[model samples]
Target chain A: MIWLPLVGLAIGFQIYWLPGLSLPSSVAAYLSLATLAGLDSIFGGIRAGIEGKFHDDIFFSGFVVNTLLAAALAYLGDQIGVDLFLAAVVALGGRIFLNLSLIRRYLLTETRLRWRREG
Target chain B: MSTIASPPSRGKGWVFQVTALCIVLGMLLALSLRTQRRAVSEGIPNRWPALRAEFINLKQQNASLQKDLAEYKERYEELLRKQATGQAATLGLESVLQEAKMLAGQIAVHGPGIIVTLHDSPKRDVNETRPEVIENYIVHDYDIRAVVNELFAAGAEAISVNGQRLIATSSIRCVGPVILVNSVQVAAPYVIKAIGKPDVLQKALELPGGAADGLFLLDMIEVKQQPDITVPAYSGSMRFYWAKPLPQPKEKSR
Candidate 1:
């Protein structure tokens, strides 16, 4: 079931891999920031699921809103001559790492408890 | 907060949404990677240093070439200046040569002057039998020489005797019955053409005690002023067998 998302990611990459497909450098920067925001939301969703706190509505809304908000903030920063892209990257990156670590600990404890029960 | 009642269903629902978001992330990643790769392949970042160095080298070469062009232009102007002076010198030499040729009687000349004709006296004493008195009635070589000398003293520019031009080495002498001028035999009526101021030449000949006075009294000479006269060039060639030209002395520096 976890592999389903990885398979979907591969499918999406192939779908965009048509010949002559390209994005301008300015748009590429925003896209990369939005991708980071998407990854952060996915990891946060995973952490919530492991804690039995996952909500379908919240997960879907967070993915859509975070991607748009990150890209929009970065573009706004560029218009205002500020490096808000860097700020967005730092904030989203820290969240991704924190969520990943929490997911890892949760998975590790679950496996440990399952092992003790089996023994 | 409204939490889903079924934990199993909630877990299942989150996976679906996460999977959908991951697909979108993948597309963004692919597009960003493609754009960056294209930017690198365009060579703006990769070849900038090499292009700048080449541009500098070409600029230096252009400067050196311009310098060479300026130098060649200066040299060309210098040669033109030298040629102009050389042409002037050639023109000066040509004029000098022409004047020397005229002085040497190697060319024909014409100007305003007088003509003097001498002939033996037509009047004679029928009974006078003395040879000296008879000789006086005929013109002599001395008479012609005297007339020529007088013309020279009166500033005659050129002189010819009966079409024979007289140069520096000319001689007038009696050869038996005929007279020789420039070694060419000539007969009288002797016509002496002198190129000078016509009035001055005629006055010199008509002076009371001048060289032509005896001939005038005897009716052996006739003088007439002409507006134009021509003197022929010397026909004979001259050669120097013993007299060689002296080397020109170098000019002293001031």
Candidate 2:
């Protein structure tokens, strides 16, 4: 069941990779920032699911809004001569790390408790 | 410990949504990574500043090289101009030298003029064969000099007597029976080749009271208007022991 998302991720990567889709270099910075935001949201969702606070509406809306908002903010910053792309990367990277740590802690705690009871 | 634990079953639907979103994320990540890799390989992102600096350096080098090329082209044209003027001056000097050579009679000349032949008269006294009387019938050095003076006054540019070309230092005189022209001995039937207008030279010698009139009466002179006559170059060496050229007057030195 856990491997289902990983398989889906592989499937999506192949969908773009097999077709050899290309984007302009000018948009690369924003796309990378958006990807970072999406990763952060995924980790946050996983952590919420572990804590029993997962909401389908929030997860779906967050993913869409965060991806679009990150790319748009970076583009706007570029037009206005600001380094908002770096800011977005730093902010989203921090969240991803935090969410990843929390998920790790939750999974480790669950596994240990289950093992102790069984033993 | 139980408070931090996962519930037995919250919502299984979140996993499906998360999977779907992960797929989207995977696609975005693939596209971004591909684009970034391409930008890096193209050397547009990280190496932009260094490449720009090298480009500016190359542009400056090209500008300086172009300036040097322009200067060299200007110098080449200037040298060509100087060479042209120098050649012109050389040509002018060459022509002046040619004219001076002609005037000095140091070069051979040929043109239309008359040839006067002065020999001992063919007529002889049949009744009295006296040597002095025969001498009166023969041509003299004065007769030859008179004929030459007449030719010169008639605009003869060049003249030669018996192959001896006459120059400004030339003299026609007799040493006994031999006549010396330019100090070179010449014999009778003196064929005087004069380069000038043939008709004018002939007419001047044939005038009733001309310098050669007496020789003409005795049949010692024969003036023929030839279409072509050749005057040889002077063969004698000329040198001045005490003559020197005078400097130009200051007022006339324009």
Candidate 3:
């Protein structure tokens, strides 16, 4: 899961060659928000997996719903003259940070225990 | 913590799904950032009917917000009038805010000033068969920027080009054949309106070797001083993501 973004980065290089695949500038906001939502779902799934609660169905549905909801919120904001995407951004951003912190703590504690037992 | 139960190994298929989704998400994020950068450097193309709809919606929302703001201000003023000390303090703060808004180009300004209109010379192609010298006959982004810089130097309080108000972050650049002011494409003839002293602005422009004279010599730019004009406030996001105020130092406890 940690290496997932790096893999995405490697694949992102193809975007330069496939210029026609690029989205219109107008939808950039929605797309970016959707990506944020997707990233949040991914991290949540990873956390769930680590906590012995990973479920395939939950991960799949959560990913799709989160993305769509985020995009929809941005579209609604554009229509209503408010930046609803900011809410999604802040929420998803906070979750990502929280999840990362937990993941870091878990990994650190696991490594320390394993090291003590081995020694 | 180390002895905690881990989830059952998800099959390769689940791994594949998550990996694929992650890749897609990464690509989308990268593409969005790239598009944002392009839009910043070379103004986004004014395409899509949806954008026009969004513009209409935004205009209506702006009107409603303005109404709400006025109502809120009136309520606040009424409350302030009830407290003499708070009223004075608030009055001072209000004036400071107004001045700050003016300086930030966030407030609409109206005053006597000059209007400089720059257009490509009509007789350029008619007389000169040489295509290389045609560049001198047309207005460029730098020309507009120079004119703006000169106007500011003359103490112009506010300025707008093609109704796009100039702010601190306003960028003027040439994209292809069109000139972009504040990332909005502006077509010729570019009518630049500046709010300041009418005579001083006019004089500053017409000064020898100034923006007006240099442009006129090259492209026959027109500078006009009008007695009354209005420059609208900036209508864009003022968010500064990278900058933050430093935390105040706390007094050391004895």
Best by lDDT: 1
Worst 10 residues of 2 chain B by lDDT: B1-10
For residues B1-254, could you state the per-residue lDDT of candidate 1 as single tens digits? 44564343444666777788778877766776676667556533321234445776888899999999999999999999999999998998899899999999999999999999999997768788998899999999999999999999999999999999999999999989999999999999999999999899989988999899999999999999999989999999988899999998986941
Q: Residue A62 in candidate 1 has what lDDT?
A: 88
Error of 1 at B112 (Å): 1.0
lDDT (Cα atoms) of all candidates against the true structure: 0.85, 0.84, 0.79
Per-residue lDDT tens digits of candidate 3, residues B91-160? Answer: 9889989999999989899989988898887757677767679887888899899999999999998999
Higher-scoring candidate on DockQ, 2 or 3: 2
In the range A21-114, model 1's lDDT, one tens digit per residue, is 6776436667778888988988998888777788777777888899999989988887676878899999999999999999899889989999
Ranking by lDDT: 1, 2, 3
Q: Per model, how many backbone clashes are there?
A: 0, 0, 0
**Model 1, position B141: C-alpha lDDT score:** 97
Which wins on TM-score, candidate 1 or candidate 2?
Answer: 2
User: What docking tier does model 3 reach?
Assistant: incorrect
